[model samples]
Target chain A: MGPDGSRPEPPDNPPSSEDTQRNAGARGRPGAGHILPVNRADIPFLAALGVVASVYIVLIAGIVLAKVFYVQLPLVGEVFTNPGYRYAVVLSLVSCSITTILSVWIAVPTAYLMTRVEFPGKRIVDAMLDIPIVLPPLVIGLGLLMLFQTPPGAFVQQYVTFTYAIPGVILAQFMVACAFAVRTMMAAFAEINPRQEQVAVTLGCTRAQAFWMVVLPEARRGMIPAATIAWARAMGEFGPVLVFAGTTRMRTEVMPTTIFLELQVGNLGMAAAVAAVMLALSLIVLILMRLAGHGRMF
Target chain B: MIHFDNITIRLDGFALENINLHIPTGAYAVLMGRTGCGKTTILEAACGLRPIESGRIHLMGRDVTDMPPGRRNVGLVPQDGALFTTMTVEQQLGFALRVRHRPKGEIAARARELAEWLGIGHLLHRRPHGLSGGERQRVAIGRALAAHPDILCLDEPLSALDEETHGGMLDLLRHVHEDTGVTVLHITHNRREARALAQSLIIMRGGRFLEGETARGQLAREEDDA
Candidate 1:
């Protein structure tokens, strides 16, 4: 319509009434593509579902927090301050750190190879790596005990014992944690586009240079979360450490095994205290990851 | 200069048969074809991305047919821009310089100069995901040029850009041709694009070039059908 108070001429190809209504926002511009109109009735259904889910989640979380923060539990403070508990905590931290570092060092390269290369028996090797995840931890403990207990064990034990000791705990944790780490890293590697590496190659990067400069940077997003999960898994590992490396105070005992040993002796307060520490550590990891914008890194 | 002496390559369901191509020093040659017509396959073969079944590829008088991509001294700007998403645009441009151990001050200056030349001077600190499609393409071109490769292969450089940016990209391609005297092998499916930027044209179909001077005429027909 002109501003001179004259009626506008009809368009050369006049749009139908329905078409005009549908294109109200798209006039004189490129179409934003044909989108299905939102169904108005589904709004109420979606609102109701969101309300119910929120309430359910809040209720579950409240219950768990109430159990975890049992303020009235007697002797809890003493259990934490106890020298024995302090030793157990330090040992757990050290053992978990070692396990995590070793697993990451070995698994990252294996994951990269598994994702980026073609070789014989790759499928079988990949499937074999997952065996530790599915097999019960206690069974894995027993297997490790056997593997290191017989002729090979005897040969190695002459230099260093792998059964019923610190080495046994480490081996068990390594076996399980490395498998989990590799699985996590393999999935991460799979998500990265291979085109990035190819581009680097064309830009004069050698294979190793491309990996360090391009692929590894892109992988940091997923790798951070994978490492957090693996560290947590290693920290909380109990069955393997218990059976293979008998729960000995100030030696092979980790947090979970210590909790179990406390429970066997009817020390509920001490057991709960240890559980609370593990829970606190897990919460710390979660909070740090959230602060780092874990999900948005990609 | 880049030379392809009757090279052939076979993939899963397609084959490039006894193809011959030569891009003279400082020439801009475009390969035009429809979808699945092996235009990109030819570029990849030239870059040594795919193994050749026969014949040889020579870049700057050196036979690179059996060489790895890293050793071929060739650069590629793929359809997706293929920027390292985690690296800043400046680092992306400086990557080749760093690999070749160029002086730090020279690398930074050259990267900035190229980025400015491509009209992406302000985006040097940003990552690929932070840039628009046109910006990413410019950065990709800058990255390739920074490598100082003797030959560059661009696979469908403008196929993904919006129409509004298409003209500007052609201008940039022309500028790149003028600046470096870099031999370029550009692949496209658009006749108008080939006409605009290509100093020479090669038409391919069904993994083989249709023989004779009828190549351009056949492309016109394909465009009409399209």
Candidate 2:
């Protein structure tokens, strides 16, 4: 009721199917015998959008097919048989697994703080977090190299040699991969309603208990995509690893570096074989990511 | 009793300034106000969900201004119920008890009793996503009352319900107050709700409060003036 002593108008209901058909007929267009209620005038616009989208899809499919046809099966087998290639495969998988675990650990807390807490210089901190994502990959490697030459980094290096070591490879991958994971987890946390946690706190659970029992369960859906993206990013990382870890054969030689070394030696066949392997592994991760998007992954 | 001694809270660009309110023990007090009048803000401050810039909040004669929400012994049912979607109604009802590490048998019995009392016994096994608005609110109310807190604060609990459900919920709320004798601070903009449930009424405008008989006279005069 309004102050004017009249009842306020109720909200308008959506038009029913019959009303829609009547309006279409009033517009001199047939509404029946059509699967979708699309405007005839918009067909050209829709077709143009479809054409633009299909071009990118076709280009990607064509590139993958070209690689499949170009690589000889025997060369793929021989590449796998080589000790250096085998070592690269094992190292890439192990490092990416470790990197994914580390990325999730760092991302969950960072994203939670960014989403739930208010503090001075919050905007500055948010922008700083994105620096690794936006900066050139080579610059990140160069920055890490310079840092290790300093006091703090040198102190850590004394304990474990990271420059041109396996640890350097993991560190370089983590720097870039963690950024993507943090972005995904931030979005995940933002989508959740904060009231749930508040209710938990009021129900005799401490803030930490509410987070672990209430918030974390809901945020688990985001973990799969974050982990997969970090794993794929680490698997493909090359520039930072090349600059900081210095492609030492059978040492820091991940699959990406193996491809680089093969290409450097003019062994295009072996490089294509390794590229094909990485492509297959990436496709599996992509499929899992898509499943996660549909809420199919636990 | 819930007492706010010249409370002040600042958030974003909005501020609730120098507001004072007191609801006596075991009273069903309803706070009414227009949208953005800082009614919900006052409730959050009392529950210790938001920080107070200045002044004190006393719950049952204890100053809980600096206390954490979990230790404040408040039972808050936020808008739309905000039910935990991952848990069954039974688990939600028993959440507070489980957090306190109550015995499994005791928790189960209390949950069943609450479920039966709230007319949600059939919904015990169902998760929140499958429940209706009224059912969710019932689950939320039961969850809040699980640990038997000293005060219960509800922020527009019936705003999302249909007319029939709203009436049913009003009766349930009345029964709850009568049975438990818990101090309640219910927030609503609807005058009918206040008339039906509030033993004491507080009207807020522009972050200030008008309480008790004075608030009632002011509300009538404002309506007449408008």
Candidate 3:
């Protein structure tokens, strides 16, 4: 063992045919090369997992299919033709786009700091950031309502009206959507090796330059999923918009608010139509997320 | 020259305590140690990637204890090369220059020169994902040398290579040191590597350096034999 109490490194020669056969035989399969032989015993476990996973997949597909079938094409056309619905659609598109941009802007830096920095009360801060993700949507809406009633919120409100306004809708959406985007970016940043940035620092890059030139480019793929998630969440935000923005027809009404407003008027057909539109948008987002994640949605 | 004086670094119950080392200018120093014996910690601390609790680091006679890594004028090649996965080999080589806002023409010329010197000119357009271990290391070395730093720190630079590649890398490292006259602090557990390239040698155990006399004696004996 070369007097080092360790196994000697193998010689630099290619293995002979006989040695290859012997090595292959030692692995319990001759001529296997690098191919792994699957064990038959694993089939039942894999099949059970597939079956359990398929149940949820089928359930979601079934619900979407039911919504699509229930909403007649004429009803969808009528919902789209309504000026209120059309306004809600435009507002939803614009607000979600803006919310997505803002969420990503906030998320990237927050995620980078969380992943790369160490500080006291870091765990507490992390949990606090995740409050929006775990807190009930209604509670979030109520919390915003309460926050705006205080001195600081009131001070800001004097300059810009957020209560029952379009800005309020965007803020409400940003509050929750940014949290989801932050989570995605955190995962993305964590997946990257910090060594690259450290190496960049040694290569004469300041911290900001290293982040911009190295970390940001590597984390660029994660932004797609983050933005898609934020956009999708913003499109579907109902409780915060209802509580903070106070769903006024043609004013603060988004796609989710349109669904709520149609239900308030006892128009099940219009509600179903809006739900179908939301479902389609969600499907598109899912497709985008999958592409970004290279087939894994999360 | 690189100097570490009474440097102390603590991480999650592990500590490198009161570490003192010096590698003279233009010297190729190889540090040998067991796994987790703070060999890498010393390199990181010197590079300013890890903060030292107490002590001073001097690069080229300037105390850099509180200085950030970028201003320290050191180049580090981390384990497995750690090439930027998003950038091509050419871009990786030009990264430091680009960050320092060097002229575009100078950056391109330096990248091409380093790539040719490292024998990776043909791999310039390819990213790090598919390069072999030796190719990646060459690209990493080229990248580190791109900025013409005062010192080069390599952590297990040849550990991942096969024997043939390892031998090539040793020759290349020797050539790089001879050509650049840059101080090098290389970390490796392999005595063969230390013997082959080290102008000065240091050994570590239990988070502290062993007696320098014994290490110097070994180097002296090797030189006498040669």
Indicate which candidate wins on lDDT.
2
TM-score attained by model 3: 0.88
* Docking quality (DockQ) for each candidate: 0.34, 0.34, 0.37
Residues A80-126 of candidate 2: C-alpha lDDT, one tens digit per residue: 79898889988998999999999999999999999999889999999
Rank all candidate structures by their lDDT, best first, as comma-separated numbers. Answer: 2, 3, 1
lDDT minimum window of 10 residues, candidate 2 chain A = A1-10
lDDT of 2 at B191: 77
lDDT of 3 at A79: 60
Q: Rank the candidates by TM-score, best first.
A: 2, 3, 1
Put down candidate 1 lDDT per residue, A152-247, tens digits, no spaces: 778998999878888888888888998988987887777676877888887777789999988887676556656776788888898888889988
User: Can you write out model 2's per-residue Cα lDDT over B53-171, one digit (the tens) per residue?
Assistant: 99999999999999999999989998878887678999999999999999999999999999999888877898776466677788899999999999999999988766767788898
Per-residue alpha-carbon lDDT of candidate 3 for residues B1-226, written as tens digits (9 for 90 to 100): 9888888889898987887888899999999888878888889998998888998999999999999998999999987788887899889999999988999999999999998888788788988755666787888899999989999999999887667677778988999999999999999987789889988889775665653678867555655786
Better of 1 and 3 by lDDT: 3
Instruction: Evaluate candidate 1 and give its CAPRI docking class based on DockQ.
Output: acceptable
Task: Show pairs that collide, candidate 2.
Answer: none
lDDT of 2: 0.86
Worst 10 residues of 3 chain B by lDDT: B204-213
Q: What residue pairs clash in candidate 1, if any at all?
A: none
Between candidates 1 and 3, the one scoring higher on DockQ is 3
For A234-255, candidate 3 gives per-residue lDDT tens digits of 9888888899999899899998
TM-score of each: 0.86, 0.90, 0.88
